[model samples]
Target: MTDISEVFGFIKDFGFPVVLSWFLLVRMENKLAGLTEVIGELSCNIAAMRGEIPKR
Candidate 1:
């Protein structure tokens, strides 16, 4: 049917970018988590240096 073909065509046109964006977002989430952890560690270190908190 023409409607079925049209649906497939629409999916073909838009699906790749949607899938790719999802994949990239998953990868970026991991990197952002690592970055957040590093930032927290850095903050702790700075606090220790300032004598606001005891060093571990």
Candidate 2:
């Protein structure tokens, strides 16, 4: 009960959707970062992946 109460208080002060959006954004950022890391590792594993990162 105390934990729930605390969580509710935090959510109320922060607002649910805002917090959700922030968390979602953070998750998306982390997922994108992970994907980038995997891609980088794959590039390293490839034979000629070391020429350049290439422009975005």
Candidate 3:
């Protein structure tokens, strides 16, 4: 059996918006770092390949 009081009780026990925002921020930072790593790897690969192959 659920009541309005119980709903509020659960919300009081668990802060919703604060937790949600923190979760999103953490994931966004991770994704941004991953993208940076990929870009750096690609840049290095291009430079390496360019050096190995002579210009035509």
Indicate which candidate wins on lDDT. 1
* Candidate 3 per-residue C-alpha lDDT over 1-56 given as tens digits, one digit per residue, 9 for 90 to 100: 79999999888778787799899999999999999999987877887788964433
Candidate lDDT values, in order? 0.97, 0.82, 0.85
> How many angstroms is residue 50 displaced in model 2 relative to the true structure, after the best TM-score fit?
11
Worst 10-residue stretch by lDDT in candidate 1? 1-10
TM per candidate comes to 0.91, 0.46, 0.52
lDDT of 1 by residue, 1-56 (tens): 57998999988999999999999999999999999999999999999999999999
Worst 10 residues of 3 by lDDT: 47-56
Q: Say what the RMSD of model 2 is.
A: 7.8
Give the candidates in order of lDDT, highest first: 1, 3, 2
User: Which one is best on TM-score?
Assistant: 1
TM-score of 2: 0.46
lDDT string for model 2 (1-56, tens) is: 47888988988988988989999999899899999999987876663555565433
Better of 2 and 3 by TM-score: 3
How far is 23's C-alpha from truth in model 1 (Å)?
Answer: 0.2
TM-score winner between candidates 1 and 2: 1
